[model samples]
Target: MKKIVLAIDSFKGSLTSQEAEQAAAEGILQVYPACEILQIPIADGGEGLLDTLLPYLQGHSISLYAHNPLMELIETCYGIASDGQTAIIEMATISGLPLIPPSKRNPFEATSFGTGELIKDALDKGCRNFIIGLGGSATNDAGLGMLQALGYRFFNKQGEELGLGGKIMKEVASIDTKSIHPALEEAFFTIVCDVINPFCGPKGAAYVYAPQKGADEAMVKELDAGMASLASVIRKTTDRDIAVCPGAGAAGGMAGAFLAFTNCLLKSGIHLVLEMLSFSRRIKNADLIITGEGRIDRQSAMGKVPYGVLTKAQEQDIPVIAIAGSIEEVNYLNQAGFQAVFSITPAPLSLQEAMEPIVARQNIRGLVSQICRVIEINPRVISSSPSHSKFSSFKKR
Candidate 1:
């Protein structure tokens, strides 16, 4: 009716956050041509995080040649703020699983060396404030390869310097941080993560994620053992027991590596993104807030984008609506604080047909338009009560 805020996440394979918000805005405008709509692109610190935060941070993309998961050179890019003091790096762009073909997706052979190279470059460029998104990584080396690129060397019992890949983890008996980049002392890192798996155990990185990165059952066990070995060495080297920390296993134990060797803070992906976006202030006066992702289910109530948006809106007593391509546990979502949950698919269609960008945009727009029509017919439909003062004040305005 008045001011509406759109803070939606990417629809995975269908639409980006910006596209989804644009489609929703179109729908709202269809019913109320003069209504004010604010679009805020959002992500859960995964693939689209750099793009989502670039404009807001006044940053530009910087491209460079870096090693992929297989240690082959590839062109990748990260974001740097205009002031040159802050840099944003998404690990997925440099060493993600998607960069390697499924047949070649070997966690044992993969490396996060490229991610370290990006950080080293940023440090060289005079950046000391870093925001690193650790998601979709292809390696399970516990950040050994990344640390190697940053001048942290790993040596075996025979004083042999080990090379990259997860298989080398077990051979690492000693670490040398003396050659580390001089600029590291001034750097402060913020790691964006969502999972809470520990460094080494059944619920740890190797057991929980290595299989997805192309490790077999035997490889998983070996990788887990390697992580445990590395953790023991890290404890001796850094005097910090980072093995069982929550989220230590995220990005294949990359979070654990940072925790042990760097001045960094780990934050929930959605919460970090929302804080960076000033989400609470943005939605303070919104009459309605719309947020969703590709699917809404049990995970949606976890630290996902919709959950983050709902929390902020609820704090201000603003009504929130969520729309998804598909949804489950509708009753649970309603009980979780979403004023209403909607599925954008107007009719039954094949998954392939429904995922087409054009079709998704149309579905989103159509769904939002109808929702706006309902509100136009009866504003109280969205408001908590007919006598709600916010709606009363909005009508006077």
Candidate 2:
């Protein structure tokens, strides 16, 4: 019996990492009943992290009445591990783009206070190590609200306290951290980040990413100015120019805030997830390793999950195949060590239609089945033409 390892990420809106693995396992076992299947559900430290990692830690979620950017009441979720030593927080869960309607999109009015509330809740539960996912955020407050929730104070020029969200940043004249949470000094904070955007510049959070969250030119300008204002205040008060730090722009300046206040270290989200899941151990000694995401393209070769897995598998000389919802630049993917590439779409269909949950699962099963069938007949067929022909000629010689 051959051994196969399935290490896959969540298919976003379609299948979870575990569900995807089981779907592939069921399909593979139907054809190759004797095959050994290893299921490793992986996450890139984003939205589906709870779905992928909670099971590993025996973690459960708790909801809190947190404040949104507009100071509106919203119930947000954060996870706590069974051991009560670690907590998982996805910033998007508290200050996500979806929480505010498109018509209400205003980076100036969004706040990270809800995320701060999650952290506070975790602290109350005696969890000292926090792994925070800093992606898909909807604010540019430079973490002012978060700091406030953690016992810092923000004041305006008139010595009056500022309000929540970036709109009030323009009025921020000073920050006082004398009463910060005592446990924060003892906490281990790891920020899972995807981009390396600096805090304030032409390519900064407000300038480059705010527009995507419905910030207009005016709102972008406002956020940019507000971030600059906050940066100056923090520099004067804390002697740290966090605005220029790498990855400081992540999650609408939440990264910078964490760095400055909570003493968090930023890391590649995929790398962190892989380490947590022991992905390298699973890839070792596998005849074949399969991994994929929602889409595969030039971007996949970057720090995405597929790229991360391929890099590790290549170290062991293990062959890998990618099954994506859609594929572009197949040649580029070939260079990334994908023995073969597959698209889950069965026919001509819109991306939305193809990404339908049930359809994606079935299509993934079908693709995995076909790949297994081909591999069974000729294991060498997984190689590309140049390599396959070279090996074939060697065999003949």
Instruction: Specify the highest-TM-score model's number.
Output: 1
Model 2 accuracy (lDDT, Cα): 0.81
TM-score of 1: 0.93
lDDT of candidate 2 over 158-250, digit per residue (tens):
899887887888788978778888888889899998778888888788898999888889988988888888888878877889878888998
What lDDT score goes with residue 106 in model 1? Answer: 95
Q: Looking at model 2, report the run of 10 residues with the lowest lDDT sum.
A: 388-397
TM-score of 2: 0.89
144-221, model 1: which lDDT tens digit per residue? 889999999999999999999999999999998889999998999999988889999999999999999999999999
